[model samples]
Target: MTRPSNMREWSARARAAGEAQAEPTGATLIRGARVLDPASATDRKLDVLIENEHIAAVGEALAAPARASIIDAHGLWLMPGLVDLCARLREPGATHKASFASEMPAAFAGGITQVLIPPDTQPALDTPAMLIRVQRLARQAGTLDVRMLGALTRELSGAALAELSALKSAGAVGVSNAAAPINDSRIARRALEYAKGLELPVHVFAQDAGLAGNGCAHEGPVATRLGLSAVPVAAEVAALRFWISLVEDTGARVHFCRLSTARGAELIEAALGRGLPVSADVAAHQLHLCDTDVDGFNAQCHVQPPLRTRDDRDALRAAVASGVIGAICSDHQPHEADAKINPFPLTEPGISALETLLPLTLQLVHDGLLSPLQAAERLSRGPAAIAGLDSGRIASGALADLVLVDAEARWTLRPERMLSAGRNTPFAGRTLRGRVRATWRAGRAVFRASG
Candidate 1:
């Protein structure tokens, strides 16, 4: 099958085929790539023929069409491009921190084709126009797909609910308050009820504000010794407990964001056992770093739901493997150089994650904690399911969003080499295995590594 030339024609063809597949500019033959589709439980050496941005066929030693471009992918691994559930592509307000122009390269370099942008910005994404503006910006940039997440509360203040239905109609995939904790349980419950009535998924960052007051690091020996206010693991557990009850009462679907503690995972698992409509994700950094990583007051280690103890980290790793935790995200917040000039306690919390997401994730695979397929699922299929997206699987009649990886390739992290404006990653100077060789969206090569 040939792909359509534009989205309109593509949609028409997709509707007729009962699938949403992008139309490529021409037929593309990817030969001898190890194709892995976690959603379909497929892992094998195969040849994939993409026509009009949709996969036309997959088999061994498939012959290429006469005019199709051939990409010799021997020894490389091909899979669906990643779908990120949480990331702050600072735009509309904090362009200096990060923007579409800067973040897209990082996203593409990391093999992420679609990223869900959070509502935390100067003018919160609370209105249909705001949501549309971000979409327009992404389209203008002409790179990866950027999905908008509208604010659950007006202005993300958590004081009042936003126009949920209108935001959805404006193309918001889901709603969230970002990291702004809703102190009023009543307002939170009402928001969930409204979302339930409209059948929208609500993404919540669980944290009890009062309990997490002025905290700059995890509440443990590290914070105690550093003389900084700490956010205890109990803060997350408390907020999750309250939110779980509301989810049960209102029957609203919820996705708990950045689950960092052992007890927190236990709460979500118990909720799932009872069949409450819920899912959860952990930050990739949380799985790899802990309170110990914050020693010497390394400002980059500061993150919301501040990295917990090693016990918590081990538990989170176990939860992800056991299927209790569905996804892993970069939580990719890019900060300007001066953002960390202040004292460690005063510096902002985040790590520049886009460039390092894949390599760091593959570390788990190297350690025997997660297989390549399992890790890819957390990065692609799992997050896509959480956001109700359509781009995280590869198959006939599906979107041609894919990435090719040199799974055993090694690279060193250097801030100057990163595409993002933020140079705040904790992994600088570290050697990481596995690197993206190329990435495609709708069968067009959007990013290709230089030799």
Candidate 2:
């Protein structure tokens, strides 16, 4: 087989390889591994056989043919690769901070086989042509499976709706304004109504600019004691209420992104209880950190919808456990070193997330907030469902997106070893228990940790 120079060609070769009638390809047997599939409620010691780009079989003590390659997994956990609902690649225009080529490896290393990139770049992906360009770039980069979210409004200005139908046809899994808020309720209603007509899901980050003002930290004692501007929790609650009401009126499939407040989750739960077609997600950082993390002006702790109080953090975790919040997103915003050079309030609000997503989530499992199977559901199955993708599962004939994790492995996060161009992670030097040993995308190994 000839090596492909670009991602498009690489995909062609892979497809052709899968289609070969008489190629007699060798199967890969992952033996003695604990197979965990949250989608099917499966948890048992089993062997997985992968042939080409699909799973061949999954059962106990599976037979391996002479032409098969065997990997001993005596104590490892094999599960579906995580599906990230929100991540910032910073490509096309913000390569100084991150690009698909850089962030993809980091994502794979963290056991994320698929990610949905938001349209928040310098030149937003509002047009079909722009979406095509990004898809082409991702294919050429050939790191992992990446799908772009088309901008809900043109250039994400939230002024007028973009061509949602065209963008969806161009391979946008969904439409979103990302962190950009639509101030005009009329425009927001129109966008949702249009999206409902097209049967496309709209993902939004709810924030009331008027209520948030210039604040960077959550309005609480921490902010008061630290002498930083406060963004009241009311900002999130009010925005969520407005969006949910719009969903009820328009019957649109809406997804709330990066929800940070306790009251915010309560609002979402109430909407869900009312049978409104709405789903929501909380960033992994928000599940662990709180306003106190920014007490000493720590810029890394500063993030959009800034970390709320401990009560909020606990509520978010409980929401995840109770199935109110279905997905966990990295909200992986990567920024250059200089972006966080200023004081806490002046610095950019984000955390370098891809590399730390998995371990941090495992921390939840250790704390009894979520079980291993529940963690897998929130990390993989839930996100996949939200994105309308047929991934994040391990089954017969399913796409072989899998990850091998050592749940007891102890490791420390170091900025020097990160693959993302942005090194502004708050988890630096934090010791984590779980670690990714290997990640496979479509039956092909994409990442392997160092021995």
Candidate 3:
């Protein structure tokens, strides 16, 4: 999947705008890199020219413009910065674990420029003011574009619906209950119907509360042998069935978040076959780990929708490769050391995953399960499309959100070197390939890894 950059030649208007600035306003020339832009199905050695906040031009041997800063990206890979849809930033609530200030850098370091801030903050994103505050905090982190998801239920209590319209006006990209279940069918139906009318997509974490009651690990041989409370795959199946039924009945666009089971993928595929306006994403970790990884009560492997069997992991990978699952996210929930230091069941469930996203995604490529373009699609175009965001492209006139990767570089995930405050990653000490060497947002250098 390689295409010659057919971008128009750089113009005088762009050069004039660049020269008008008192500062250098120099264009950035990234040369000799293998550009993998899935939006255009492009994968080849090329040069990219960035001016102001957009890509000026992209092609082989693109000429260096006046006052341009050249980044010799020989032997590296370049692609659109990932748009992560489920990065739960612990801000305006649990700063002790990780704040927007901390996670934003980790996001950038992982080649993520745009991230969806889930609605489960301390005060929740029920109020426009709370959403505004979270957005503000994220913006202050420099070049990280954060889209806020308004609370689907007031304070995510699953009782009263939040001011979805107000939150929309206040810049919410979507609405979600954020892991909270609306036990009442009438209220849930009304919420979906109302949100559909408002043209807002609903992000749902499908899990039957009762079925998953007190479950800390997936119902499998691993959990049984470990004597852990088991969360059966039925929990996810029942919950997804519930949401898909609503999507079909209400004609509401719904996104299934962090899908964990093979049965869940089958259901999502069937719903899509029926032409329901539905989408799905899996956390990067789920595509790699399974319940077996939880052996020895490794608290770091603990996560909601607890890791399932290897068959389930394989099914998920197949879904992504076949486009049945269109997106993959970090599902980042950074917790303090003490939060995960307790016994497996007592510890908070989540992985400090912002920094592992790119490497793990690239691992799928290395495994030959996906081509480079397919990998880029899952990381960028696919997620951006789900969020209805104007991102995840590397063509002319596209926002200059991009990452330069040392695709051949192998590195160990050392907790001390991580940017996120939470040192609770299961990938810690694991050697991963495809390191993010540098990242840019809106054409400005934001993160450059020290070799």
lDDT by residue for model 1 over 363-395, one digit each (tens)?
998899998788889899999999998767878
Task: Give lDDT tens digits, candidate 3, residues 1-451.
Answer: 1211221111122122222321323499999999999888899999999998889999988899887899999999999999999887777777656666666667878889999988988888999999888778766544578898999999899889888999999999999998887898888999999999999999999999999999999997898899999999999999999989988899999999999999999999999999999999999999999998999999999999899999999999999999999999999988777898888899999998989999998999999999888989999999999998988888999989999998778999998777666678999889999999888888877777775
- Which regions of candidate 3 fall more than 4 Å away from where they truly are? 1-25
> Mind giving the per-residue lDDT tens digits that candidate 2 earns over 1-451?
2333444343344333323311233478999988889979998889999998889999988899777878898899998999999888887887667767667777888899999999987799999999888888887766578998999999899898999999999999899998788989999999999999998999988888899999999998889998899999889988999999999899999999999988999999999999999999989999888888887799999998999988999999999999999999999988878898898888998999998888988999889888888889999999999999998788999998999999889988888777666788888998988999878888877777768
Model 2 misses residue 139 by how many Å?
A: 0.9
TM per candidate: 0.93, 0.94, 0.93
Model 2 lDDT on a 0 to 1 scale: 0.86
Worst lDDT window (10 residues) for model 1? 14-23
Candidate 3: pairs in clash: none
Q: Once model 3 is optimally superposed onto the true structure by TM-score, how far is the C-alpha of residue 392 displaced, in angstroms?
A: 0.5
Question: Model 2 Cα displacement at 3 (Å)?
Answer: 29
Give me the runs in candidate 2 sitting further than 4 Å from their true place.
Answer: 1-26
Q: Cα lDDT of all candidates, in order?
A: 0.86, 0.86, 0.87
